[model samples]
Target chain A: MLKGHQTWVFASKPVIRSASAIGGPFEAKGPIAEDFDTLHSDLMIGQDSWEKAERTLLEEACDKAIEKAGLTKETINFFLSGDLMNQIVSSSFGARTLTIPFLGLFGACSTSMEGLALAALMVDSQSAEYVLAATCSHNASAEKQYRYPTEYGSQKPPTAQWTATASGAAVVSANGEGLRVTSATIGRVVDMGLKDPFNMGGAMAPAALNTIEAHFRDRQLPYDYYDLVVTGDLGRVGHSILSELLPKHQIEIPLDRYQDCGIILYGDNPDVWSGASGCGCSAAVTYGHLLRKMKEGTWKKILVVATGALLSPLSYQQGESIPCIAHAVSIETE
Target chain B: MLKGHQTWVFASKPVIRSASAIGGPFEAKGPIAEDFDTLHSDLMIGQDSWEKAERTLLEEACDKAIEKAGLTKETINFFLSGDLMNQIVSSSFGARTLTIPFLGLFGACSTSMEGLALAALMVDSQSAEYVLAATCSHNASAEKQYRYPTEYGSQKPPTAQWTATASGAAVVSANGEGLRVTSATIGRVVDMGLKDPFNMGGAMAPAALNTIEAHFRDRQLPYDYYDLVVTGDLGRVGHSILSELLPKHQIEIPLDRYQDCGIILYGDNPDVWSGASGCGCSAAVTYGHLLRKMKEGTWKKILVVATGALLSPLSYQQGESIPCIAHAVSIETE
Candidate 1:
């Protein structure tokens, strides 16, 4: 049901029956490498192209999640997916492989939470018995499309965040025992006229703050209502900016409970200038690391705000400012 | 609420309170030009670039629809949109301008009905009071990204379809007196391993057929239940293919009621090789021409099956086949 302005309060609390994360070689060296259900030593995962490798990651995540849920591809009612690919071909091809009724989405990196929110809504409304929500991104694939080809050995600026090659998928069931999706806050597009694609973290920070503030206001929850509040791939720059902006807006949360997927993905890695990013960063960390912690009773309730810098290479080339958005979904265990 | 596999029957029937379509100069010369709410004499619509022009078309259509519904942008609860552009910049930028809470979808050309179906579901479930569903495409922009640049004047095959420069928007509300959305059948990704991007209609025909058959089967409705069964943009080639394939599956929709938006857009224009296409083709025809006729009581019920070819230039260049999808929504008037 509609709660306030942009939030949906799911009365039935659609349960996250199972989740799986798949990663590439780069992610296997990261701090939370063990959290992923499967990690490929080869970035290609035996695929010919980087794009195909990205699609393979999504397929593996989805298949693993479905298997973990004790369900087959035929049992799922719908598959909601998207990726940081032109025309979202990875998701479309993955959908073809899965053969589930599919809904393709495009929210850049925020696609992870966007799919989850809509999937939870479908289950809560009795529209489906089971729905699969998934998203992915690949470093080489994204680099080739948005910047330069991986073979170029391009030197990125300090503000540039490394795109993580990863994919995550979750199965939401109408009847299950697991972490439940309690509510969701859809985001409004926010642009501060920032045009730096390399500094996506800075460009997206405002949108992240906007949705987080809206989520609290609409849900009418206290600042400490969530045991943990994590953002999707905001990197170090955006994370610091949000931490600073929150207090200015009179919003207060303990620093210990405030974390970011981008910052956590590759802790202190020198190669990643700012931090890690991409649709897969938040997805892999959340579904893999965070969800595992929640299942182990490390936290009972948490909020995952997936942020996206909605800019194509062409948009920035055309001298347009970066438009950003964030979608927040609250997950809790009884 | 769940009718059968892949179908949802809305019990509270969400109403299409208002709809508006905008078009470029080429579309202004079409047979149904007068049906459009606004037709720009210049393809640019005074914008400097084709992408911005596409965004402008979406903005105009949304504004017109909201005005027709006597509602302000602030009154609308959410905006669901998508486009054919890379990263769907048109919808993202349009959402930025509107400042509405947004959900960005990527269904290639099927975005129109995909947005409509999601919007109707939100309204029918009381998750939103008023939701705006919109999509757009610019011919030049799509040509530049997907094929050759428009300025290249490259010789295209006779099988190629013209990408339309158009946009369409509709307002779906929880309570209204207008055409009601009764049911929706979400489509699965259907790839027949068709590799010719030039002949998209041929590649997408199977998807359109699959969804149409699923719609009839899941809704437990006869093929002739609808006064009209209009397809998105199968064009001349795919239209004939579908016509021949239908009877083989024991599905018999009346010939008079079966139509394609691609075939109707240009009438007998030789310049349009096969017919019109893009995310905007079906959108403009259905929201402008079809809805107008229904309002005038010329038809009581219709099915709009928006089809899409989910392939990118990279995918085709990598020798991957085109994956296709179609989403169908049932609109009726009492």
Candidate 2:
């Protein structure tokens, strides 16, 4: 019984509806996925409610996860999840359906890892037999909140992570039937006091570098100990910064071997400017690709490092600079 | 040994800053307890980068947590934490100083729990005997992103949670001489599909009610089994609704025995209008008050139930209703 299984990534499947992908107050509607054209026009004026849109998405994902895991709603212990809403509408609204307990979390994009880590603890402590950790991101809403809306046609900086147009979820248990949170290394905040929220990719690079280095050192493992070291939505600028930072420290992790959400979401598409960021970035990547690899034994040991930029508009207005952080955990399947 | 720790709250602490303490943003900007009317006017229009602010807060808090936990920058295994920023600035930026492995999380306000849960997993799995968990919240930033900004002056319904103008943090370790994550119950979302983002107090009421009810049932523990059944930030309206709903379900838990962040922050002051709700609401209560009680042996078993109303202003604008969820985890001081 893997106590709780959850994942975070950019997109489970390629997003077809670009309009629905975007979300946020100024988006004029939920992501184009929620039928933005007809659903509501207030999303344009920043008066729309994203909580409901997230709720519907979360509910669908949860239902699918439970069904795939072959568990009834009653058997599950609680709904532990969260999102970018003021009160975390995604998890909370979805949680209203189950008769079980629920927990809503907010760690930004790193939420999936946090949920998985917690689920691992529950199982390790024998506190519960199973749990769920999940997160999501809507392109339009996120764009409006972070940058300009589609109407604005703002140019994204190379360091800026494209808000992933997706959502990802996972189920962890103690049964050992799936991947296990073999080892989790907590990452502390490391602030060089870098400003520029738009360039979060650059700000978070050092944190990511530090975490990956620490994870390898702490475990007494080499860089190649894992098949891949993944970073969440570092975009082009941050990716290069991390690459250079690692080599400068005499740590040479293969650039190709290490993946990022920012680069992965687009693959070769022109729609996504720099790359994907937000919770969906990590959520979709982990759930859609990494887990599949784990199950197929294509990869044995993997390090999923999800990074987040914890800035708010107010902080920006206060003339405060930007700070970055990252969390790294190793997962392996038997 | 405790791996890491960090803490941060509003620079200004207000005396009447309760759930019902209604006031405009910047109304209590400067040190409220000692100084007032010296509001920081520059924070009016978004200026500085949010990334910088997040980085600063994370660094400050991590320094304190690490100092208190007696962990050095080098020996720390990893950094794990989250926040409300789109990219999880708190953990990412904070990770820079520690120079450790990082994992960012997003569980909304449940992020503190998410961090703790992950820390516990790392420790218990024998992968790491030391780890840390930290979380933070900013009232102005959170409000503007999730709800209307103080400038919006939107009339909040009775059920709306009062966003706390504060932040709190903690460190969880395998060797810390403090309370451990003895037993935790993971939650699964059960959406009642309740709409109405503004009235999350009502939307989330069912989820909280169900989770509390189920926690008792799943563990076969009576309502009286714990010292107090606390909800994060259910304001007056939601608290009343929950109180009524619990009894209606024939689960007569003492209303007085239960606590709400909204109510606790404001004793009798009605200025706030609604009760308290925010990442900081339950955070301060748990880390500041509840932790003290646990240490003093005044309270033994605590079922800390954090509630989140999953609604985004953009979602509401999409003409979508709000959804609510809650997570219940029992904390006992052994």
C-alpha lDDT (0 to 100) for residue A113 of candidate 2: 63
Per residue, candidate 1 scores C-alpha lDDT tens digits across B199-261 of 999999999999999999888898889999999999998898889888888989987888999
lDDT for model 1: 0.93
Question: Which regions of candidate 1 fall more than 4 Å away from where they truly are?
Answer: A1-4, B1-4
Candidate 2 chain B: 10-residue stretch with minimal lDDT: B1-10
What does candidate 2's lDDT look like per residue over B1-334, in tens digits? Answer: 0011011111111111011111224324322212111122333223253334334444555665566666664555545666665445445546545655556555555555555545555555444445555665665566656666568687866555556544455555545466545434444444466666556666667767776776676566676887788877677777888888888998878777887766665544566666666655565566656666677897877777777555556556666565554656566665
Question: Can you give the DockQ of every candidate in the order shown?
Answer: 0.70, 0.26
> Model 1, DockQ value?
0.70
**Model 1, range A133-158, lDDT digits (tens) per residue?**
99999999999899987788889898
lDDT of 1 at A21: 95
Clashing pairs in 1: none
Best by TM-score: 1
